[model samples]
Target: MFAIFKIFFGLGWVSFGGPAAHIGYFRNTFVEKLGWLRDEEYAQIVALSQFLPGPGSSQVGFAVGYQRAGLGGGIMAFLGFTLPSVILMLLLAVLSSQLTESSYFQNVVHGLKLLAVLVVADAAWGMYRNFCKSPLTVTLCIGTAIALLLFQSVASQVLVLVIAAAVGVRYLAHGNVTKDKPASATRSFSWLPLASFFVLLLTLPLVGTYSSSVQLFSDFYQAGSLVFGGGHVVLPLLQNIVGDQLTQDAFLTGYAAAQAVPGPMFTFATYIGYELMPSAPLLGAIIATLGVFVPGFLLLVGVLKNWQQLAAIPAVSGALVGVNAAVVGLLLSALYQPVFTSAVITPLDLCWVLLGALLMKQFKLPIVWMVICFAAAGFMAPSVANLI
Candidate 1:
């Protein structure tokens, strides 16, 4: 258990580049270097994460630890992997008020916001290429995006996902079925975690009315339960939940900071939680962080023992295909509304974004360097404007 915590704690500090990159990091560390699991076992964990909601790469890491050392190891893995980002986000929340007064600091925040734009665009486009290959799937992606852009509500998001799943089961089910393999011995899984997940999900909102902290937890928990694709897709849901409580700039700044950090982007909740409850910021951060992460881990624990058999079901596979495509669409909508609109106010901003894209795509520069370049550009923007 200590080893699991130590390994994941080390990873939390250096696992940059969001979910896809984290997957690579886990593959290298657990599969190649440590020999903790076979490549196929690692692949199955990754696949399971993709099909379920919450932080994708974090779930993969947790499942790996669970496979290694049981439930206690999973908890250790989650704590070790999430601790660094939680600390960083809390510090940023505490410091942001003092820093906002400085012109240079404001520019730096603006620059990081632009970085958010670049990061989300890359995620949306990459997922599009991977998930929207079929004509039917492409239509679903475009339709979902258009629907969300028009309606822009949590209900609309859920409705679209449901419809996509139904469509996938009807049409995309063809060719997805596989022949049955020889039955392996079934591993027993406790149902308590799964039951607890639903109990909290349903009961939290009712209890949340009496306490601010409970409300905060309820909001994050709902977002974690529903987010299908990965961390980027959490943006719109969170925005809908808390956008009114905080300024748009503050919200985007927290998101940009998450991009700059080196762990699960879901730690963006820590920043929001801290900002939301100024008097008891640490308590807020803890509650919000747990609320957002707990559901996914619970669901993973409940289903992991049976995952091989469950994943083999054709309808399940087909539905996931649709859900994945719809997720890309949801991200596309988020990219346009809050990410692109909030970041690119002038033609110069657009130019900066284009340049960042070039560096990311053509030169393949690291994310840390991109953060530095954008910060510098933001600092100099005022001088450049004067010259122009």
Candidate 2:
């Protein structure tokens, strides 16, 4: 248990660029570095998680633990993997105001922002290439993106997602999917712990912690539950919340801070936490941090209980292809809002993006190296400022 927590928490500390990037980290650490799983095993699990509804990385973590140990290891692994993110987000959430004001800090923020764009793009493309089984699947992806942009309501967007799923399932049922061997399904063995966690969360309101502190907690908790895709997946939902209530500067600052951090951008929970619920800043931060990841842990356990049935679903896999294609669109949208909005201050900054994207696509340069080098360029360039 301790080992699971330590490794995953360590992953939380080092994960940068967002969910897609974190997936890379998971593959490297668990499959390549530790030899915990074969490459095929890791790929199969990723295919499964991307097929499901919850956060992909957390699901992967649970799958790993479940593969190794029973329910106990799975639970420990889930919690451990998420702990570093929870702690970092809470701390940063408490200190968001200070970080936003510093101009020198913006360089690192912009650098991280660029990498996020590339990572999301790469992930979406890979998924689309591998899983987009038909033109209808392609249409579903395009349609989802258009619907999300056209209608701003969360309820409406969810309906579109469901529609996409239905379309995918129909496509799969009609098409062919044959496998030689069946995957193992996980059974429920830890309902007690699951129920206990739920009870604690459910009764928080009755416990009388419902101050501004609790409000922040509630907001991020709701955010965790509602968000789909991965970390980038959470952004549109966040925009709906932050863009309306907070100052543009506050929003931008918090966003910038999120990029510099090593863990998931879900830690943006911290930034919004401090701004939305200022009283008991640290406590607000803590709530926000934990709240964002709560869904990941819960869903990991929930999904593992029915593991094989999920991975075996052809429609689910098809829908994942569509969703991943949609993810590409989401990241493209992100390029303008968070990446370009802040980073393209100077004409010279444009060079950094072009170079960074080229490096990733053409030469296949490492993202971390791109972040470090480009950040230096942003600082050293004398004329760098908002291009517009």
Candidate 3:
């Protein structure tokens, strides 16, 4: 447990970029470096998280930790993984007024955005090789990407996954997936966890009508529960939920801050909650964070024992393949818009991404070092801009 906590805590500090990058970091550390899980094992966790709503990357981390050290380890992993981003976001919320005016800081954020492009590109490539092996899977990847690029929203994203699953069941049903099953799932388990998951989903809305805090929890929780293709997909839902509470500038600032931090992108809630309830920032942060995260964990717990069994079922396996392929497409579409379009603003910016990608692929520079270099570049970009 200590080992799990320590590693995740370290990752929390440096796991910048976004969900795709975070997945890459986890794959590198746990699968390649530590041998905590095999490639296929890690892929299964990722695929499961991709299918579920909530913070997909964080759920993957939780699943990985659960596999390592029981339910306790899962909780510890969530804490260690989220602690840094939560703290950083809260601090940013408090100092948002000052930080927004700082040009150097803005440049640093710009650099990080560039880093996001490189990191996500690397992740997409790696995931493609690992998950999109068959021609049908590759076609699903492309088709999902085009569909999402055409209709970009939480609703469309979910639709794509559903369609993909249906296609998978129809097409890939007979294909084999090989992996050793975990020992824990072999034991008897209860239906209570699954029951509790739906109960909360149903009850939260009713309770929310009476209390503002409950409303906040419900809004974020609902966003977490329903937003597919996590990270970017959650943004519009949150924008609508807190539209009246925060000014557009303040909300945009928090969104920018979220991009700069590590851990789960869902920690954007920490900043919003702190801003909304300044008198009780800590409490607000905690409530919002847990509200957004708890549903995913609950769902994971409910499904834990059934995962292997479900995997063995031919129809389920086919749907999983479809879901996995669609995930790659979702990532591809995301790479173009908010990531690529937002990051690469000029020829120079494109050059920076190319350079960073080389350093990442050829030199295999540590993410921390890449962060430092890009931050320096960001700090200097303003000066370079003036000269240009």
Candidate 4:
């Protein structure tokens, strides 16, 4: 258990470049170095995470920890992997009053936002290739993107997913998509976790009426519950939640900070909570962080127990394909509206984005170094512009 915690804790400090990158790191450290899981076992875990609606990489980590040392180990793994980013986000929230007004700070933030743009673009393209290969799936992807681009509401997003699922069930269920093998250990089903998951999902909003803290928790929990793709996909959902509470500049700044840090992007909740409840920043940060994560973990425990059976069903498998394509579309829509619009302000900004994406793809530069270099460039760009 201690060894598990120590390894994940070290990873928390350097695991940048989002979910796909995190998966690669896990495969290298756990599978290649430690020989903890076979290649097929690791692949199954990732497939499980992809089918679920939450932070995929974090789910992968938790599942690995659970494999290592039961539920306590899973909880410890989460704490270890998320500690660095959560702390940094909380600190940024506290300092936003000063940071919001600094031009140099704005420059640094601009660069990080560009980084987000590049990251999301990469994610969308990869998902499109993997999940949207067939013509029917491709149509669902494009249609969902167009729908969300027009409506830009959570309701519309949910509707697209539902429609896509229905379409998949009607069309793709009998196709050749592979299903992960079920664990013998999980053959016996348990209902308590699934029951609790729904109870919380339904009851939290009503419970929140009596307490502001509960309301905050409920909102984040709902966001986490509904998110499909993973950490980066949480952006638009969260932006809506905090839009009334924070200035656009401050929210974007926090987002930039999230990208600069080295853990799950969900830790951005720490920044939101601290900013929202300055009188009790630590408490707020804890509540927000836990709120966003609890639903995902609960769902993970509930769904994985029955995943094998469900995946075996043709209709369900087809629906999942559709859902996956729709998720890519949702990310694509988000990339255009808020992420692209907010980040790219000048021709030079576009150049920076293209350059960053190229470096990330070709050179495979460490994300932390890329962030630092781009930030420095942003900080000096205005002076350079004047000289030119």
Best by TM-score: 3
Cα RMSD for predicted model 1: 6.2
- Write candidate 4's Cα lDDT for 1-388 as tens digits: 8888888998887666566556656765787568998654565566567666778889989988877887788888888889978977877777874765678877766776677677668666766777888999899989998998999765786688889889989987874534443443256455677788789899999999999899989999999888876677899999998977888988888887786667898888888887777778898889989988888888777766466456556776787777777767876886787678877998888988888978878998765677676777788879867876
TM-score of 4: 0.69
Better of 1 and 2 by lDDT: 1
Using lDDT as the measure, the top candidate is: 3
- Those runs of model 2 whose alpha carbons end farther than 4 Å from true positions after fitting are 1-98, 174-201, 209-256, 268-288, 313-347, 361-364, 381-388
lDDT of 2 by residue, 99-194 (tens): 556666665556655555555555555544544556776676566656656664546545665565566566544334555213433343346545
For model 2, give the 10-residue run with minimal summed lDDT: 180-189
Which is superior by lDDT, 1 or 3? 3
The number of clashing residue pairs in each candidate reads 0, 5, 0, 0
Span of 10 residues, lowest total lDDT, candidate 4: 176-185
Residue 337 lDDT (model 2): 50
Write candidate 1's Cα lDDT for 259-324 as tens digits.
Answer: 766789999999888888888989988988998898899999988977755545677567767777
Candidate that beats the other on TM-score, 1 or 4, i.e. the better one: 4
RMSD of each predicted structure: 6.2, 5.9, 3.4, 5.7
The global C-alpha lDDT for each of the candidates, from Candidate 1 onward, is 0.80, 0.61, 0.82, 0.77
